[model samples]
Target: MWLEIGRQHLSLWRNIEIVMVNAMIPWGNHLLLPLGTLREPFSALKRADVVIVHHADMASKLEIQAIESMVHKYNESVPIFFSILAPSHFIRVGNISYTCPLKDISHAILLCVSAIGSADSFVQRIHKMGPMHVDRLDFSDHHSFQPKDIDIIRKRLHKLESDFSAVPMMVVTEKDYFRRPEVLEHLGYEVLVLCSSLQILPLKGCNEESFKKCLRQHLEIYNLA
Candidate 1:
């Protein structure tokens, strides 16, 4: 279905196909459909004129090389770029307009709560903030928080507070907070929403400027812009 849609777009003569890949699990089990995480076969990468790898910060150099090799296997000349979700700031849960500094959690105990695609990446990033200790409550991607889940989170937080004998705060990704702001606000505890934006990583001659230049070149090639 997606290939058909891409073909339809390309048939218009002004469209260029770009594919985004998650660096954490590029090709889950290398299987397709219900058996694995991929929607299409790896060979489908041949259709992509440009490919951007997300969460590049979390992946190691070897992993990126493997991904590049795999992409080149299908399309040797496809332009590959790397990007990371750079955490910008934090917003208080109840008051969305109130922004908090990333250092606010420094030397503080935090319970990282998230239901995102890359929970490990989110937690690891938090660890880098110099938190006294970080505990996590990760749910499956897009899993909505239920009453029982709330109870579980509360219990975990309570345990952390008791163990550390300090006030433990809750932190969640922007995706989780936006999914159900009211749910987090009602937790009756300090909950912060970590916000991040996509940033181009400087790797193998790829940076913000080069990424834009490449895009412009592609646009000129396809006459899209």
Candidate 2:
């Protein structure tokens, strides 16, 4: 249905279509939706004028090559690009606008909590920040925190404090923080939101400028620019 809509938009309205693949688990199990993660077959790449692999920073060179090989199988000439979520700064749970330095959590015990799709990436990024210790609690993507969940987190925080002889800080992705800041703010532990922004990675002759140029070329080809 989505593919048909894209075709209609392209053929009828001359819209340029761009497709994104998750570098973490592209074509999960290589099965379509209801059985696995793919919404369409690998052949769907043929429809994409531009293909972007997200979370490239988390993927290894071999993994990226595998993804690129798969994409090229169906759309051999399509321009492929890579992107990553680059951590920018931190913000307190209640004070969303106030930015904090990434080093604030350095050498501090951290309980990384998140309900985002890429929890591993989130935790990995935190580990790179030189924290004294890193622990994590992952829930399904977009899971809303409830009172029971709060109790669980509080218990974990207590345990970490007991073991480390210091009050461990709670760290979460911006998505989780904004999902229910009120609930998080009342957790009674210092909670910080890890803020990140999408950045194009320089790979395979593609960088930010080259990615923009590719978009412009596609728009010109479709006469949509």
Candidate 3:
């Protein structure tokens, strides 16, 4: 049904020449079900033209090789790219929205709140900002923050101040920030939302220019067709 819809759209729009499907595979010991976050079997990756391995930087060299080997075992010729999720900026949740650099949060004690798939990665990225400490409050993916959750956060903040003798800043993912902006703002404390973006990792034998060229080559083929 999806393919039919794609065909119909292609018929209507002459410019629609190529269709690419991406599979988001994170770095983990298992790429299949029963243990890790993977919903589908690694064999399903055979259907993908390009496989993107996210959190590439988080994986060690040995782990990357293992993942690459596993992927090649299934699909030898498909282009596999590595990517890292880097924090771009922090959004201040208040009357007037503003952005701050990660450097600004340095030496700060942070209360990290997130309901993302990879909560540990989020915390690790926050630590990369050189914060003095990060007290994480993780939730299941897309879990909405409730009043009780807010209460828990407040208690944690108080504990942080009492323990560290420093005012701790509240940090959240951008997704959570947009989900409950008003709730977070009314918490009687300042909140800074971290925004992240993906960055492609250069291959072992490829330079930036060459990798960019390879990306462009894929799109350039459609124009010729």
Candidate 4:
């Protein structure tokens, strides 16, 4: 009875046996989904038990509020909530946890990035890693990458992996890498990726406890659980 609401293939919906819905399902070079339309129809919101909103940092406050409003409007009976995202809670780097920072992150090289969750937010979370210097290759949520595409990416990485290159490694979000298991193809370059979770400190109402509230909100909606 769980449904993962997204624009396309997301890990949360990957192994789900039931039918899944998406806003925009990518098909090769084309998008096959209608934006904002749900497969269950608007009336199905009545069965919803919760409404979770996210992307507070990357999106404007108005945007987040708008999402909340949309969810509430669709399922007024459902309890609206928030949940923290990966990289906001902590990052697992090669089986190790590392505290992420907003500044002074230009230390790691070659960021192999992918996410069935939030690619933008994850990339932004590691912005301190570099300014336009990071190898930012994002895949669609649960993207069944084609051999051609993977080859292209490998070639691109090979071409980009050099001493003068920005970062000579691959960084990926743990979500995608864990699911497909084919994302570990950084043979000729240093590999770097987000491991597990990260702690986030919001700029507004900045406090440990209040931040915890926001974190909870993000997790409730964003997490597959």
Quick one: ranking by TM-score, best first? 1, 2, 3, 4
Model 4 segments more than 4 A misplaced: 5-39, 88-111, 115-117, 128-132, 144-150, 162-167, 180-186, 198-225
Indicate whether candidate 3 or candidate 4 has the larger lDDT.
3
Tens-digit lDDT string for candidate 2 (136-211) = 9999888999999999999999999999999999999878877888899898888999989999998888899999
**Which whole-number lDDT from 0 to 100 does residue 148 have in model 3?**
92
**Cα RMSD to the true fold for all candidates:** 3.2, 3.2, 5.4, 8.3
The local distance difference test score of each candidate is 0.84, 0.85, 0.71, 0.49
TM-score of predicted structure 3 = 0.79
Residue-level error in angstroms, candidate 4, position 77:
4.0
**How does residue 166 of candidate 4 score in lDDT?**
60
Q: Give the per-residue lDDT of model 3 (tens digit) for 41-99.
A: 55655654455566767767887787678777878986766667778888888843577
Query: Over 4 Å off in model 3, which ranges?
Result: 1-36, 206-225
